[model samples]
Target chain A: MKLILLLFLGQVAPVEVRAFDTPYDAGGSITIIWEMDTAWVAKVSRIGIFRASAPGLQDSLIETLYKPDSVYVDNSAKDNVPYYYRIVVYSDDTLIAEGKTASAAVSTQQWFNGKRLSVLIILIIYTVFLLYFIMRARTNKNLYIRKIAGLEAIDEAVGRSTEMGRPIVYIMGLGYISDIPTVASLAILKRVAYKAAEYNAEVVVPCYDPIVMVAAQETVKEGFVEAGRPDLYKESDIYYLTSDQFGYAAGVDGIMMRQKPGAVFLQGYFYAESLILAETGHSIGAIQISGTTAVTQLPFFIASTDYTLIGEEMYAASAYLSRDALSLGTIKGEDYIKMILVVVILIGALMESAGIRILTDFFSIF
Target chain B: MTTIIWTWVAAFFTLAILSFLYKDNPLYKFAEHVYVGSSAAFTVLYVWVFDAYPKLVIGFKEKAGMQKYMLVIPLLLSLFIILRFIRPLSWLSRWSIAFTVGMAAGLGITGLTQGFLVPQVQASFLPLFVRGETVGQTVLLTMNNVIIVFGTIFTILYFYFSREHKGVLGVSSKVGVTILMLTFGASFGYTIMARISLLIGRIYFLLHNWLRLV
Candidate 1:
């Protein structure tokens, strides 16, 4: 049997094996690749991957592949550690041929992932555009920003609330203070709260988060101070409700029902409770303006609210309401970026249609 | 006996909450207050027990060297945030807030680019024309790709705030709005089904768990 096996093994060439640290990764992984004569492939029933700390040490089998797979990644390797690898080809239960790496491969943590180079490039370009547009906007104070109805109705909403002798309710939805939407909502809150203060109409804010409640209090205070009515700033009005989603909704609904506010501003991130709050506001006959980046809840806002800021519109609200040169420039820069993205998509689609995958490959090379 | 009492209590609260559909009254108010008050208290306890105790107290006990020292930064930042209550030292809280805001911005940019932008743009790069086994299959694939390509472009154009919606932009935006509305319609239906399922669950609980009717 040994003589017959030797003769059979001698007929096929040794498989070429290479082991190396996986690139563009944090670390702790090694990739092993093997190439063998195609003619000898049919005879191989399985391949086994074996690893060891050193060349002289006994290699322990890590994984076995039943099929003729050419590549395997060993994710169990330790970072900054050298590893020796061996690949064994087996016919049924018997080892027929084997290959080993010429030298040990060391898995090292990469300082930077080359895969994210494109994202970094895009970000740098966007920053440059934003800075340039901001400079331009400083000189040309008349930078054009298309009108947003939701933002425009702020004054009107406040005025109506004042006329009706009713309060204005501003509910920053279930978002942590760290959320960008919540930050954006704070900006809009400053403006709305300022208007309410000027009109001598109360702006009630029921917060979902304690941190957000504090932020809202500060924002509303600033708004009141700016409106020369610091005394009207009620810290008690902008209070934390409950952390629970449904509980927050119930709390807000109760506030809306009890206060019967003339205008309601639903802004920031919301979940399933979006519709509940919006519908309650609607039922109370409050003129509702809702804004969020939550795609799942936008339809609920649209169906229930008088004015809805969809997706990016909410992001643009701060700049739109403020009309500040720096903010407007950023918005313009973002719009230009959107245009570039559109052009890139069109070009990529065209290239893909022509069966030239250059553009597709460029985007896909993570 | 305790299980039966708890079930009865749960049933009472459920009925009280359901009564809000007809009109707001004392029962609904009682349930609402209970829910909010308990949830707030529960959340405080939950955070202290799960997040604060484990990550801070246990981490301090388990970690060593640089890892242990690393916990100090977060501890100090958290302490600074809590300092907002001190009127004279309130400005110190801004440092912690600034750190949070900066971190959020950095994470947002990287996350949007890596998670959404790159993958979305790559997936949108579909062959406009496909040659399949049959002419019908080929046509269908081609149409699908066309819709995807155009839909993405038009939808993006709709959100372009710099340019006023006019001419080609207007037409494209209109198409985009139509597609968005259609998507919203489908989403509405899907979400309603989920909400209905939740309602069904509640109904099942009332019958099976409480009344033993189902």
Candidate 2:
């Protein structure tokens, strides 16, 4: 704040403008700011801003602002294009003070953003824990993942199918081969397929994507080989049905009707078709176990299925079932990361309560 | 006249799907086959014409110097996808899968942090006391904020895996489950509303388009 007495003075200090590329942005934006003289600011009628794309070109008048104005952001400047800015102060159109930046401000792309430094740090910490735990697990350290009811029941579902002399139907929901949930679901299917092979119960997998069908075949075959039942593994058991959403649902529903499968496993990325599949299984009186990360489909599974794995549970199901060290270690690492987030939120709340925004401001950077 | 024919076709398929509520039948089977066959054909055509053509043919034709050479990256990646069909070369598809999955994780982390983590954390902070407000409003506002802060924290606690969920952790997880259940219930209700509205739209289509009535 400048002293109020400065308003009566003939001259105010020259406007100092600082122009730099906007942080955390893709590119092509430059933020401009000029220091304000709060006291001398009263006397100034307006300030006119001018910009030139490159040096020696005529500065185009961009904007004008009245008293109390201190900043003007020029976003029209293209990336790699040099920008020069001039700020002119006027009292009733009579120029009182003028300043122009000597150096050109050019917007450049930043691969690593300074603003997301906090998020990057948190990610690194989580990754370190994940790698360390995975290493420990690979070395045969027992990582105790909690007893997930949905996973434990997989054995019972497979056994029941075997005893009843019925086939088990596994729908690896409607996700493409590349989806994370689909990957996790495939992991769980390995365990399911192994259990089915061990018990000599037939397991049929109907896939939406052709690539997923291929992956499913490999997984089930590998599972049977691991279970020492490779001879029992049928190549045609896992097949690509259709890619159409409702058509796939109809196909699966038809299998549930005709085959009357004893056990049904629904996992991966489901959509509006989840209700159709789960509700049909319910009506068929099959022991249905459903899991997915799709929040919208959770209720249908929960309402109709015997056991439903909630969002993260669907991803963690394979690790819990197979007790793999690396996967278990990764889940533990994610837990620790969640704890860190909780701490940050608590500290932010405390700061906000005290009217101190230091912590909250840091979190808001991203 | 052309539109009328298409409308009748669409209406026929729509009714075939709706027949699913009664039982799976031959009519439903026909619609299912037609839908799958047409959609697969459409996807192949769409990918070839829109994406594959421009990225490959046009890049080679129009791209200059270093830009043209850079097309080899995508070209090689796509070749991995083609390898999936060949029995011996099938394992080579892992390269493309790894590239895609790796990119998805990297992109997901960035988006999740910016879109979910930061905004949600900032939003969780709420000032308890107002400098100049009635006591009732202050209590209500403070209570609202307190519930938001606590609910979010405890719900996240439920997902923890290192220490077995027992003792104090167990209590927190119980609360977390409650919050999660409430969220699922609300989401289910919301989805049901949207689904019902879609049903209404189909019903209107049946009444107006198929039957030609009000």
Indicate which candidate wins on TM-score.
Answer: 1
lDDT of each: 0.88, 0.84
Tens digits of per-residue lDDT, candidate 2, B12-110, equal: 999998887888888877887787777777777877899999889998999999999999988987887678779799788777777877887778776
Candidate 1, residues B69-175: lDDT per residue as tens digits? Answer: 99998898888878988989886777777788789888998898878998898888888898989999999999999999899999998888887889999999989
Winner by lDDT: 1
Q: Each candidate's fnat, in order?
A: 0.70, 0.53
**Candidate number achieving the greatest DockQ relative to the actual structure:** 1
| DockQ (Cα-based) for each candidate | 0.74, 0.54
User: How well does candidate 1 match the true structure, expressed as C-alpha RMSD?
Assistant: 2.8
Q: Where does model 1 exceed 4 Å of error?
A: A1-14, A36-46, A65-68, A79-81, A100-103
